[model samples]
Target: MSAVGANTSPAIGQVHVLADSEKELPVPKRQRLGIAVVSELDSLKASSATKRDRKRQSRKQKQLEKLPEPCSSDDVLWKDIVSVLGGEAIDAAIEDGKDVQAPLVLQEEVELEVKILGSNGDGIAVPVDSKQPWAVVVPLTLPGERVRARIYRHARLHSFGDLVEVVEPSSSLRDMSRVQCKYFGSCGGCQYQMLSYESQLEFKREVVVKAYQNYCTAILEENMPEILATAPSPLQYGYRTKLTPHFDGPSKSVRKGSRKPTTEQPDWLQIGFNRIGTRKVLDIEECPIATSVINAQIAPMRESIIQNSHTYNKGVSLLLRDSLDTSVDESVDRLSDAFNKHICVTEPKSTVREKIGEWVFEYNAGSFFQNNNSVLPPLTDYVRNAIFPPSSTAPSTLTHLVDTYCGAGLFAIVLSPHFEKVAGIELSQDSIRYATHNAKLNHISEDKISFRAGNAGEIFAVVQDFPRDNTAVLIDPPRKGCDEFFIKQLLEFGPKTVVYVSCNVHTQARDVARIVEEGRYRLESVKGFDLFPQTAHVESVAVLRRVD
Candidate 1:
């Protein structure tokens, strides 16, 4: 062996490698499998590519999840605004890290400078934006003022917002004295105290016309009687006949460890109007809208309740009604005497007495009465004459009349002389009792005029046997309007005529639609009474005659 070869030789048990021409060196297993190495590299690349694809897909899905859901088509987006011109845009901001380009391409953002065109205790409307062209309604805004508003809710093309700030003021803003009460805005007793009386009438008239034309799809003829043409209340101030006060509680510890006050304090609860634009009752000691007598007794009543908290529940609502007959002061002697006679013998009466046509009604302080007392006679007369037109041929053969929802029997007692027989139906037991007492006070034959206590919707069932041809029905439904059952029964009973009195035009229109659809009655005459000044509330009467 050579010296270099011997030094390189493997020690002890190690093997030595040598190349020879005849014998080939053993090949390693890894070197012999070249395709396996290439396949393993390709497999690692494919797995990495799949993981990258999955991560990209997950990122896209997360972006898609951030989008807002679409709104319903019938959603009332701009109902808060009360404007005729409809052009407004939405104001919105893009989220951080969001692709602003996507929203910018699909949605438009606009800043609107608007003037409050009108208000109906619900919302204010501003002219639409020329750039955006969508109707917008703003809440908590008054008419005749300029405001900057940002739209929050969007619909098809329209948008709505809340009043941001008042830039310009209206000419009709109430002077300090004109507001009359300190709590004008807080108490919400009157919405139009800030507006002049004439302006109030104009606004109300516009509201009526707008509601009829816009919501009801009514075609009002120019020759039709104007709703605002009627006279307003003779006394705008102190016109309310009834007032109701709520009590919160007094400071007193009724029981040990209870959350009751420990010191004696004046009862903070009393009769008052609801908070402005809300249904909550405001704790008011006095209300300027109520009559003096009603205001005078409020503190005493509160004191009485507070002193006898154990006897009187803390949560009870107190009411004061006016029962005196003031009709004689107006030189309406016939009506005055009728009311005095009817109310004189009844239980203790309140302070206000109103005369409608030839009938006088003495109501409690908290009872409901037509606010526009001056126009009440004419309004009632119009209804009576339209329904029971004095028989030109024979006055004695006049048709019999039924007054449904006849609170205090004002219609029944006043129209008793014109009808051969009259009946009044009311749900309130107190109202029925008052109606009966009213007929007696007028010295009218109670036998000729009967009172029934039940639902007005079921009045026809009670009087279905009455002669249909010679009978007329007078309905003065609540603000919500008569139910479908009442309309159906009225049609089925088929009275000669129906005089519908309503405080809401939308419900009135719905009821009229039902009547016309039944094909039993035709619309004859429609009239409106501005009983509530400075507010959108209006009283309307529609006469429908049976088709022959």
Candidate 2:
């Protein structure tokens, strides 16, 4: 299935309106949503992206890019839009089981007012002139904004387009003053930078609402709560602790001890990210969303890459992670002091330290950890309060917690004090090893806290001995969410409370629908967290309490 949108609509390019791959199992539906978006993916803890799952998703992505799957009856989002916009036109266009002519041509230019925004932040519009039901997916657009986009790829019911111009912008949502990036329309790094920060939060909340509306059809509409207001990031800009600036030096593979005879290096290398709707790398000197330490490192790093361009083959991303001075334990308590003493680490294996509230986390610079450090305190607080509410005696109420997909044991270690016992389940032994070491580093006792690596599908088998009624399971899976097998096991294991945190709400809704399918549990609350403030991405947490 060609992912019809970007991961969160901020990084939009190569997006397909319809996905064709129902053949691949384990690759969840929402995994099929953001195809070909640069893999600068966030590693939200309690995440489900094990090595095997990522490879499967990577392989599936290749297959999707090779073939565009036509929209089927079950592709509800596409079908609903087509029915709403192009009912008669679709019937007219279809002849002998295929459209006689595509509503828009390749490279055809058209100015269209966006009727509404898709869940992924693309503006969806129907051809008003032709009264055509065919839809166009345009990035960097908002509803009620008339924009000119060039049609690039056509699917069965809709066409994928590149935003060419915004002729008439929405009065309310469009505020040119808020757009800080000079490459607003062209760069794939951001989408909602044009809108006010307040608007961006609301828009992301709306995304959560739309995802549930589209994917959670199995659950009765009246039963679900309105998505809570999106929590704003403490700092909107210069909050990103990590940045990966990349460039293509030379295509010749770098082999050990190979003579560097003649791979001619290009005079200029675009040392940055992908351009909007294309794989071409765009040169970015500074990122407003990145921290001061990371921004300063870019120049020196780019200089090094350029200087050593002749020695390299293939494109490479230079990692710039901000590490705090952890030498003094007291400095970690003061956020400003900790941030003032920050170090930039370029190597993947180098240690990156982050202070989340009072707890400090240490992880490999290359591996996945939450990029936004500012909002983590609130994010973790929300997770903690969900089980042990501010009004209630939490630790006394819930004695045990099982943090599944607990990468580097962020949740387990953070929430350890509140629980009588905490078990962190992960597929990577290395992560578990890190978790074990982190517990000791944080002065958490091994008797009260534990970390183990287990297969995702059968993770509960490792924690089968935990008292179900006294336990809560904390899951923050990847964009795809939990597979059917894992969901089945979850319902069977039947913990007292289930707290699911997700980066992609579409799959979260899909997974939530399954969890509540048998009426064993009821969704109590759903809240959106603005981990990445300037972008379209929203980290959502859904709390489910057992009813039956």
Candidate 3:
């Protein structure tokens, strides 16, 4: 043999012993390895790649776990949703779609008669005049309408379809005359813009009804009161105080090196909500659902974003909040005219002000406050009146109110006058700070109202001494609703009454079902508030009384 070992092929997993390369010595070679491959012979440096991949995969898994989950999934549709839409009809339709005789190919077009509008505002349809096992969920359709739909996705129980044509229109439910937004079907921001406002409210009531039916135990439903009519917003089109317009960088599919983008493509920043059933954003010139001030600012905001597109690396939501600049005129008379002075605040950390009747609230624009300022007065009034109904307040022993998740003390401050003592607990230090400030701003004293910071478990522990028989708990949790640990703790505390306010009725129903289980509490009533009019979103309030 030559003076040195001379095998030429070297791969990531293969060990190589080498001498310095020279034409006379040996040829040096490196062979590519399969992706994510592992071998005992893999070099230390080569193993680093596998380690990186594992770590990156773990990070992605954690991120996915943190994402919000919808009420329905591919495996099973919610029973109440199925019942409300088309129970046996849907089942039959699904079977027909999967039938060997009439196979549902991808992008297959079929005329379907929509049976009912789903809680999400999509139309549920079955084959026209066919006793078949197949159903197609189509958007921009109404009940009793014959619509031409193209099957795009076939799920386990049902299929999803794109609305191609309305073969026969619904005279009652389909009211396109009232549509405010051009992006009604395309944008995910709204679902009921085409329907009458009254119809939207009615649909919301149906949502609550179905939510309870699907999410709650029969015992809870038996105790549940007639779900009150969904309260409507005063300004349906221009009520939203906050609008987050999102924009993304250019699509990766565009060939960057091939052509000048200015000549071939649209501007890079595609700003708006996600297109319905898609992750892509649509460019929007005006959002009619947002407040007047935000709409007026949209032109300038879009221009600024376009001008600084180079600064953004990925998609981001730009907050455009409608807030009153009370500082411009601090006079008592000016407070009443605050709405006329609405200004659009773009910065998230910037403080914003809104007045609900006589009470004023100031919080960071980034904070989670009610989006519709018009609905707060009636909503708060309903809650305050709900805690101790007029007939029960005088003889009631409930003198203490515990406001959980009390961001900026919205409910606590609003109900403080009715209670002898009130305490607000929040997880965010910033929210707690705002709550304390808001109490002072609203002229509530420390002895009457207080704010605490920590998790729900910690807050309940600190308030353990409060008499369960004399206190009422008001919980306004995030859309995901309360966790099991928190619910268990809440049951242990056993307050006299519990009022739950949630933006997500589905999750609220699930949580309240647990609270009212085992005959421990009676669900007094459930009501819905149209906090987001012209959209499918509804805020639900469920009142519970101890019965154990």
Candidate 4:
């Protein structure tokens, strides 16, 4: 059936509210109480550009040009905020045959064929008939899948919905099997478990390439390196070494910000993970993505929580870390058995051992380490080999290596053998402490590898000591990626080689664009690692060399 001709209705930009009884899925109380203010959009005007738009653009550019150079993007944190500013939605009791004027009215069900997947892994379907500008985004539906969905939200650009069911599955679903975990759809932990392992790798690669082409196409026009083939994961499932399951007490009628404790008992302890898009928690039994040892602790952990659920009047987050593998070595296994038991029983305060390749790393259980231990060796080796290319006929001219945002010193410690001296800088003292211990654990000399708790604002302050022409800087920033200040500082420091690692490719592409735009660095190569299998997340590493 053609989706366009079925029950044709007038375009509406208003928000719609559904009664609690009409909601198919149990929405969190917070979402049910949300006030949506949608803007009225003229479909024809929106589709076609106007002369006033050019004038407005010219005015905006003039204003921006007047702004001071080196403006404080450091203080500015980029975020996308959508707000609804008008009236309540259509009545909850609207007749079934009656035409609704609300575009994203709750309980408004539609059958859509998904055309593509959005960055957050949602299936986007633009209506073939609608003169309206917005598309319907349905979660848990793949590209080319015909799905039934109920609209719940109206953002500026698109409408969001929850998938009711797949009416007709995509061809890709032929390769996909049933999701292993029972809580796969509800839990936000994994997004692509339904997709086959090989397909997941390809999807991740497409995500990286699309992000760059969409956000940083101008930079690519200058010098776009072919994004290399995605490195496959050694283990698809049972790869994660850590899991943080949390619990929050049942909702209360107490006044907000009141310090007084409520005498009324909670209905039940809501534990496990936050529901896919809501603050509501779904009690979890097992996570297939986590290591077998970590999954084994779920029963005992739940038992403990049940026993103390009454005491937990507030929210609590429990950390489970399978830091050590017993199958690594005989002697080390015996020594780490006590440590592993201690980690499982109590909160890890001291260092925990994690076996990666030949080295046993000592890092705090809570510290930042590679999430997927199975793919960490290959990821690290790729970075190490990229630093010194075999194709280069000249010997290594790089004397010093500086690693910024060196959490637990993974890159610094592993790549120490390639450089004369490596200086690792971190903002967190706790991470630096573990990093130092990890270096010692790996038998790296103190003189050769040094960890420092340095200021992020002054990240390149230490690079002054090393010759810019002979130094290489490695940065593996958090998911938000580096700000303009850091990128500006990096450009000023002007190292010989820069290896940028990031989990979020959009931000990585943005930062890399600035580096190449400055005409100092040329993009050498880009490679993605499937560190997070069964999910949309991909770890990407980009290599850039100083233009001679």
User: How far in Å is the alpha carbon of 75 misplaced in model 1?
Assistant: 11
On residues 15-77, what C-alpha lDDT tens digit does candidate 3 reach at each position? 766545554764444433532222323444557888999999677546432423544432124
lDDT of each: 0.59, 0.78, 0.78, 0.71
RMSD to the true structure for each prediction, in A, is: 15.3, 17.5, 8.9, 15.3
State the displacement of the C-alpha of residue 16, model 2, in Å, after optimal TM-score superposition: 54
TM-score per model over all chains = 0.64, 0.80, 0.81, 0.76
Q: Higher-lDDT candidate among 2 and 4? A: 2
Model 4, 136-167: lDDT tens per residue?
77778788888888888654334678888788
TM-score of 4: 0.76
> Cα deviation of 506 in candidate 3 (Å)?
1.3
TM-score quality measure for candidate 1: 0.64
Clashing pairs in model 4, backbone N/Cα/C closer than 3 A: 16-89, 37-84, 37-85, 37-86
Best-first order by TM-score: 3, 2, 4, 1
Judging by TM-score against the true structure, name the best candidate: 3
Distance from true location, Cα of 366 in model 2, Å: 1.0
